[model samples]
Target: MKRIMLTLILLVGIGGYTTYAQSELSLQECLKYALTNNQQLARIRMEEDMGRFKTSEVRAKALPQVNASGQYTNNIKKQVLAVPGELIQEPGKTVLLEAGTTHNVTASGTLTQTIYDQSVFTGLKAAKAGEEYYSMQSVQSEETVIYNVTQLYYSTLVSREKMIVLDANIEKISKLVNTTGSQVESGLARKIDLDRMRVNLTNYKTQRTQAQNQYLVQLNQLKQQMGMSMAASIDLPHTSFKEIESKAVGALDFGGVNLDNRIEYRLLKKQEELQEFQKKAYKAEYYPSLALSGNYSYNGISNKFDMFKGSGSTASWYSMAAVSLTLKIPIFDGFARRSRVSQASVTLKELNKQKEETALALNTQFENAKLQVQNNLTTIQAQKENVDLANEVYNSTQNNYNLGLANLTDLLDAETSLTEAQNNYNEALLQYKLAELDIIKSNGNLKSLLN
Candidate 1:
């Protein structure tokens, strides 16, 4: 009995875990998941962190730098020096003497501080712009992810809706086929009518199968965009058509919108700022640099290699300290600085042109999104009315055929009209949703999708 209980518990546990892994996601949940799990967004976040470290690295150049160094040498051949012998009362003669020490060691610690360096200071300032550029890039990446995920989410929803419509048509036609079969048996309908009903039923079943396949494909795409496993089964709850229609009732006004509000435009502006900093960094190369440096050093020398021993004829040691100021003035660099500055200036000009072009382009996109939203909303309303009319016609024809007042041909035509109307309505609805997302993105409010 215990073994059976354990087996049941294990099976239950596995089932629960599988269900959790395949849990259904709402649009907001999908967006949130993508932000946290999408590989590209994670990379962008890492890049932002790297940018911060880079800024710190550049800033450190302006701070005091301290370093320690040590050196030891075994002079296998001593260096000889030649001097006139007159100082030792040997006139008109030259003497050669070897320098002392078979072993030597020196250790030093040095500190350097920059007092004035235009180039370093410019680089430090540029670091801030570089950080800002990376931050803007992260924001842009997030917006792009949100846009793409939302698009896939809505597309999957539409495909599911299409499947529902197809299923309904199949069910309705199956009933009609049965009714026609009965009428032919009763000799009230011609055998040809029964044939027509069967053919219509077959077509509806084929369409339904195609729609089901399409829905599965779209669901897989949505899963990929959300960074979920493609094999995971996700169930999306049915969304009411009325709910979608309600969201599109109002016209969007973009007259007060500015290009700067858009993330893409802001990213371009950040790029322009970074380019200006680059130009400044290049021009700073012509300025002189000044620094302060100090060093403390110890030197030891001996005939033997025991420079650190205190027992047997210890080595002599001496300490020295010095502080100095260094000034480097750029006199000429074979026109290298001139060429770099010119190149930087040209790049700055190019960025300015790109900024202008981007602004114009953003404005155009905003206007077009606004127009598309309005047009698609109108289209949705018209298609909704058409679908309603088609549905009513199908119902009336079905009733008439049951009463032997209408032929199977009339019923099949009504079914086709209804199917076409539903498909058109769903397509228009999808377009309106996409247009709404565009407007939101153009207004720099794509983040609102999370809400």
Candidate 2:
């Protein structure tokens, strides 16, 4: 008997551990992990980084760049000549350019300052504009990150909640089976009642198993997407969808309202501005440019490659500076510049269209979300009544069975009905939670709430 009791206690412990492993996870932690660690977010952030560097690159072009150069020459043979009279006497003969070991070396520093350059200026400005555009895109990406995290988090919550409902039903059905077994042993119920109970219990068990599997799968997926470590376990918090569902069913604080706060809307606006910048830059391409540049050098020549020994060499230094003006008259280029302007203009028009289309789509989505939440809330209200009614019916039938007024069949039917109604209530609660989350997401408020 002690051995049997020990075995039972171990089984219970195992069951408890399993239940705890499937516990509720916190929303805040999930969102944090997902935003910071998700691979998609990381990739998008890399793009944003590239944009930042590009912006710096654009700015760098406007600054002066200094350069240095050096040169060395060695003569295999030193040409000899009398300073002047000997060179005149030897005019018929080949006269060398230098005497003794001849060496030529030059080192210089040059600076080019762009006083003005139409193309560079325009390109720099465009690069800056591009960076701003990418930064705006990152904003949109952040919204996307928020959206994806909420979706997976809430979706997993829903699945786990659904599994809880199934598990409850399974428990209730198991109890019914036990009750029927008792009745059969007492010869008060037919064997068929026990068989029916077994079948119902088996069905509920199957459903519970499926729900459990789905819950685990969703949990794993959420964990992986959030870049959670395998060693860390997910524990979801138990949340009731009742009040949220009720609110969703009614008109929200923002019914038939526009969410200009949406990233997509703002992104489209930025795109329009970007197009304008491009058009302006294209226009600026026709302007002229001016720049200033100068260089200085030091040279020492000798038979040796010494830096300081240069007595035998003619060492002289010269410097030059110039101001330049460039005129890009845009004489003709097959109308390519005009074509680019047209392209930019066309893009602006397309962005306008895109803005319109996105607004419409968002409106449709919010409307649908509103309707779903309201409908689910209505369902919850009705399911609540059904649960109460089923509970009453089960109680009455069980009382009758105990008093020998109703048979096992009636009691079993009542039990099954009550179980189903309870499960339906659970489903209604979860639907309400999900619907509310959807509304928030549609309004572009997921970031504010989750992150």
Candidate 3:
């Protein structure tokens, strides 16, 4: 019984340790985990594999193809042929003879090698380019996942920080409530003052509860983005706001935004390349094709159903073989090739238009991100000053109330203003961080977060 109890205790301890280890995840670790486990990203990887297989299939078309086949037949009702009596040396008489054999077996093998086919060659190129396009698409998908997970992590961190601030405020208010209650009982403070303090304490506690709930909601969302179970518990370090600000301050130093750096632009360019190949493939349809082919077959015929073991004198067997070079000239196809070529041409034109549109959109996003980063930085600086001023005012008010030079109402109001300023600063910090991420992304540096 003691051994059993010890075993149970050990199991619980191990489970706790495992959960704690999993909960201690940094931003980079979370991004890495999501890349490995995300369902959407997994699907994109599967498609990338499919693309490779498709390329192999296209390449196979250019190689020689060999096939073998076999067949067994019973001519249950052979066709009869009418023969002229004179031809058979029987004048004025006709003869009817059965054609073919009662039993037949045949086996054959064939080989076809493509010598030259413009369309096939062009298709192979297109398939290779298509594979490259899928690869680029997979990279684009990874970038997207990284961006989402990072944003959620920052948001959840800010929410948690806000809850921390609320808890601190609640603790301060609770202490003040106790002090005021003691003063009221000893006749050093009024009943009204104590009652007002209690009211403020209640309000702070309520706010703390709301902030806690919001933090949990944001944490759940972060978990979802990381492809983590909703029921899992996670612990993010209390990363100082100053640390985040310091890291983000130099985000713009990544320099100029080049359209080539953006994955979306790169993917579109790859698609355009594939489309060019498609146009060539359609045009190639008008060209002729050449191929080398060979066939070999053996046939056995017997009146008895004994193709495998028939006596040599009772069964007849024959073999046939042939080799040829085939060249096909496309004379006409009722203008089909011409129409398809025109369609491919038009599609290429549309792709070019899309490229132009994408270029414009990319530039717009970069400009917007730059503008937002500048604006958010300015806001953060201003809010930081506000927080400092509020803190100073609260401290002075508290001192005045302690010396009996200020009313309880004034002190409580000062505290409220200070809390408001702190929250505003936190919100500004969040905006700044989000804008910083945008700037990094616009500069095509999201992959840097992986480090």
Candidate 4:
């Protein structure tokens, strides 16, 4: 019984360790997990596989097709044919003759091969191009998933940082409240001043509570983006602000941004190719198609149901074979073919326009992302300075209040400014990170995050 208890304890310990390990994920690991487990990415991969099968299906149309068939019949009532008796030396008399047998059987096989079919060839090409299109589409989807997961990961981190700041402020204000309460008890401070300290402490706690709630919500959102179960407990290990700032600074020195390197542009080019292929398929309808077909058959007849049982005089068997070449020349079909060609041409023209529009849009987005990143970087610097100055002012005001050189009101105002400055700096940092991600995405380097 002691051994059994020991085993149970060991198993429980291992299970707890495994759960702990699963809950700890870094940003890169999170992106990797999402790429492998995301439902949308999996669906797109399946669509790409289906495209390959569809291409094979189209290719099968050009291959030889073979079929076999069999049939049997039993004559319930035999029919009779009228004949002239004079033909059998009977004068001016007619005779009736029974025709057909009581049983019949037939088996046949046919084979067809396409010699020349413009439509089939065109369709094969189009299907192949379609496969390429889906492959590009999958790449685009993966890039998008990476972008979303990275954004959510950073947002969750920022929320947690804000909560940390709020907690620190609450601790600081709680200490002040204690000191002022003692001062009031000794009649060295006004009751109203002590009341003000209690109110400030209360506000700080409230803000901390709100910040904690927001952090939890953002973390849950991040988990959802990573395709993780929300019920599972997870922790994001803290990252230093210095590290983040250094990374952002490094990103500002990127090489020339190329719109053509972007996945969106590549996807658009693939779409255009697919549309061109479609137009070719439509035009191929005007051409003729040629094929070769052959068939072989065996027949049996008998007066009884013994056609396959015996080769007796009452049963007979015969065979037949034939081969032919068939050519289908397209004839007039109420201008349907012409209308299809016109429609396909119009679609191709539209696709070309769309491609141009996408190129321009991508160019604009890249430029805008660059501008935002630079502007946010500047804002981050300014906010950092503001936070430093606010901290200095708050420290000086606290010292003055303690020496009776400043009022309670001035101390509270300085504290408020410090809290606001810190919050704004954190927010600016978050925006800077977001803008940097956007620039990476626009430059078609979002996949670098996985590394």
The candidate that wins on TM-score is: 3
In candidate 3, what are the lDDT values of residues 1-451, reduced to their tens digit?
0000001112332331223232345678778878876778889999999999999999999999999999999989999999988988998888898999999889999999999999899989899899998899889999999999888887877777777778878888888888988988899889998888888888888888888888778877766776666556665545567764554455545377888989988988888898889888878988899999999999999888877774544668999999999999998899988898888888888888998998898788878877777777777777888889999999999999999999988999999998898888888878877877888888889999988
Model 2, 1-451: lDDT tens per residue? 0000001111332321212233333566456657777776678778888988987887777899789998877877776664544556854455545674566777888887777766667777677777777777776776676666666666666676667766766776687678778978999678887797788778878887887788777777765676554445555544555555456346556445455767778778877876787888787676666667777777665565564545543444344444444434556778888889899999998999999898998888888888887788788888888989999998898788778899867877887788789778777766666677778777777676553
On residues 85-108, what C-alpha lDDT tens digit does candidate 4 reach at each position? Answer: 987889788888888988889999
Report the number of the highest-lDDT candidate.
3
Sorting all predicted structures by lDDT, with the top scorer first, yields 3, 1, 4, 2
Q: Which stretches of candidate 2 lie over 4 Å from their true place?
A: 1-26, 75-102, 245-251, 302-307, 310-330, 403-413
Task: Please report how far candidate 4 places residue 440 from its true position, in Å.
Answer: 1.0
Candidate 2 — what's its lDDT?
0.69
Q: Looking at model 1, report the run of 10 residues with the lowest lDDT sum.
A: 1-10
lDDT of each: 0.80, 0.69, 0.81, 0.80
Score every model by TM-score: 0.90, 0.80, 0.91, 0.90
Winner on lDDT (2 vs 3): 3
Model 1, position 50, has a per-residue lDDT of: 90
Candidate no. 4 TM-score: 0.90
Candidate 1 ranges with C-alpha deviation above 4 Å: 1-24, 82-96, 182-192, 247-255
- Clashes within 3 Å, all models in order: 0, 8, 0, 0
Q: Identify the superior model by TM-score, candidate 1 or candidate 3.
A: 3
Q: Name model 4 segments beyond 4 Å from true.
A: 1-24, 78-99, 244-251, 311-314
